[model samples]
Target: NLQLLTELDFAMAKGKLSLDMKAAAPALNSEGRIVLHQARHPLIKKEDVVPIDFELGINYHSLVITGPNTGGKTVTLKTCGLLTLMAMAGLHIPARSPSEVAFFDLVLADIGDEQSIEQSLSTFSSHMKEIIAITELAGPGSLVLLDELGAGTDPSEGAALAIAILNFLNQTGAYTVATTHYSELKGYAMNTEGVENASCEFDIESLQPTYKLLIGVPGVSHAFSIAQKLGLSQDIIADARQLISEESARFEQLITAIESSQKEIDDKKSEADKLQRELQEMRRTLEQEKEKIAKEKQELLAGAEAQAAEIVNKTRRQMEEIIESLEEKRAEQRLGHRLESELRGQISEVEKELSAHRHKRSTDQQPGEIEIGERYEAIDLNIEGVAKSLPDAKGQLVLEAGQISFSVAADRLRPVGKKPKAAGRRPRAGQAAGRTAASLTTERKMHATTELMLRGMRADEAIAAIDHFLDDAVLNGISPVRLIHGKGTGVLRQVTQDYLMRDSRVDSFRMGVEGEGGDGVTVAKLKL
Candidate 1:
């Protein structure tokens, strides 16, 4: 347990260091490929290290890297091999996320000098011994790193031997990365399948390495250019350039042109990536704004509905007070038949308005038009009745339910089965059937005068008298009824019109026109 704790402490310390270095956990790829994104060597200072992007073992099994010396080609080779070993050993690699490392049974490398003076083996001979061992041991599960393959020998023979060795490794299915300065090797990679060329960039003006790895572009040695920049005579440089064949010079020129084009392509790709990110951000912002607007719209609607409800409730309470006052007058036997009829109409209208505000009717089934003399059901009151009159301008119609006639809104009633047939016999001309004393009294009330005199009455008394008169006028279908309230101080006329305005049965009221009693009277139009 103590040993296990010690190992835990060591792991925690390593994790902290990884966080400080911004290292990412490496992903294992099963397709025999390694992809390193912005990978830097851990031993190198972070600011000084030039991160490299490298990939292999998928499109190509072998990579032949060519570049000028001290241009980071060797460092790239070492970085790939070391990172692979680190990932396989379960250590976080100094690379960005999405870095994938392939699992290899053996990580083989033949980098740097291998000369052995004690064994009497020259540089070329020593490298041959190492190459022979690699050829024997490397297989499909090996990650081989061969730096400066076929150096310290004749250029033509060495280039041929390098190509042959690379072909053998490809046959073995080993993932190989090698560095060389031979132009023949670059040509071989271009023509051969499953082989790719890569290079490190160098700045000729500064005589410094940029250390930027560019895949699919062969490297240039810059031998003549470097010598001239270092103060070598122009004649000597020209003489040296002439030693090379025209084919070789043209091949080098082609590589230089390709490098420039690759740089431009990389710049365009970066710009495209930046634009894509900005568009994505804009889309997200627009979506959020849309959601906010929808939410605010719903809130506004809810507030308006609440305000309307409060107004309805307030109006309901006022109407209830008016009904209570009429009821009190009726219980005291102070209301005549006309006033009693007005009270019932007022109660019916108020109840219907209140019921509509209280409940929302379903829209699934619609109520058909209510025709006169048709049997229908009052949905709110839950009572069946027969329509006695067609709807008025306000959609209110008279309904006779259980021998009691009352006004109801047309929307509250639904037709019941078929309309009833007219069965009652018509009275003879100038005569009526079952005429009685009560009927005669009703006829006299219906024929009441279209004018009411409130000239000498108080405001309260005139209000009550005008209410009764309007009710009778509406029952008798008399519109533009006149009220003689007089122009004395304008108090009576003001009160009269005010009462008319409040009464639902009164459509409108105004001071009488010329020859119609002028300002001394009020003319009210009742809702028939």
Candidate 2:
């Protein structure tokens, strides 16, 4: 049954495996450059994918891998050697595209256990035979894999012999991968000019082998995360980490910091994009207002001109009737008679009355003139310190901006100074600043932080936006304002507290208790 299970596992692994040998394959070149583009291990399950790709430096020659048991040290060696062998054999490797390889005369592998049952040869003797075969068959183009090289011997002897064998392979200029539990071999990788160390990634969260390979870094045992995952106490994990080299700890910290910084940058970019959209919306609203005001002004001016024309026509008709009546009366009367005198006196009186009416009408028709007490249309004159007042006789007129108490006559007003040539034209005047009545009714039209909080973002995100808001709020100089975050998961509230804790400008912040909106709001006090 055990044999059957093993065979089934091997078949399944083989069936799931695939390889690519096209242009898209990782950077493997003749210059001893190792590139495994999107290369995944065939033996690893799809669910537990071990994806890794790396180029052996253009100067790469050999590598020695060292890590905890089953940490993928041996697996990495096999993957590298097997892929190379497969490529040489004209077989595709599980890479994204074509793999590059140079022709080699011999391929050798010595992985897994080999115990001689006949007792005719000892372990060391058997190992020597394999080594002799390699030294004899190896050429400049040979590729070799050695598992636990010089292991199962005295520690001092094993390390010395391993180093010697590595040196020999380096001189032979053959590609090689060797794995060992000995720490001394790692030095061989580090000190040798063309040799490097590679490792499989392990997760700090799950304490499971991510099986992801990272080149240029020696593998770590990850005894702490593993131990912790296995139900060890915190004290044990802490002690284990303490025993690790400070450099390794620092390296892990650097990786986490890099990931965190990337996320933060992405968040900030999103925020900036949102702000840009808001600004665009505000501009659109302003433009619409200007258009509406212009239409209103057109309608108003048309009505005024029509009224003025009608009045002038009516006055002319009335004057003509009076003159005709007087002429008729005079014609009927005898020459130099009493009736003629009476008719002349009546005509003279009518002429005086007409003249008075004309003078009154002219004086009353004051265009663009602003009367101090009367109501006037608020015109955004687009000039600093000036606004267009009621029209008096001459043309449009401006009153000083912010002095609603007084009005300037239209004849006294002048055109505002022009902006620089490079400046774009302001929205056409005569349109009321086009804000919808609904928009102006309330100031709380989704404060910048509100949207993020509603999206269930992290506390840190809310805090950052609030920090930005506080800076702007300081500019606005709003005092004793309520922060309406709404009743959320309490994340916003906690984040608000954290922000207030750090902000020197905030004097105090209190969550609305019971009747004051409970957790829905926070009232903040700022120092100026």
Q: What's the count of clashing pairs in each model shown?
A: 0, 25
Winning candidate number (TM-score): 1
After the best TM-score superposition of candidate 2, give how far the Cα of residue 484 lies from its true spot, in angstroms.
99
lDDT of 2 by residue, 222-333 (tens): 5665677789999878887789699868755654454345446645866996899899999999999998999899889999999998999899899999989866754443
Superposition TM-score, candidate 1 onto the true structure: 0.55
Which residue window of length 10 is worst by lDDT in model 2?
A: 437-446
What is the clash tally of candidate 1? 0
Candidate 1: tens digits of C-alpha lDDT, residues 1-528? 999999999899879978877899989975679999999988899999988889998789899999999999999999999999988877899998898999889889998887888989888888888899999999989999998999989999999999999999999989899999999999999999999999998887899988989999999999988999999999999998899999999999999889878877967976997899799999999999999999999999999999999999999999999999977875454445456775557654654554464236423445577678889876555557899998899999998976578788887777887323346967443223212322433454435788999999986688778777776687568887889988889988887887788778888887888999999988888888
Instruction: Estimate the TM-score of every prediction.
Output: 0.55, 0.40
Runs in model 2 with CA error above 4 Å? 1-31, 43-48, 120-128, 228-528
Q: How much is the lDDT of residue 302 in candidate 1?
A: 92
- State the local distance difference test value for candidate 1: 0.84
Model 1 stretches astray by more than 4 angstroms: 275-528
Q: What lDDT does each candidate get?
A: 0.84, 0.61
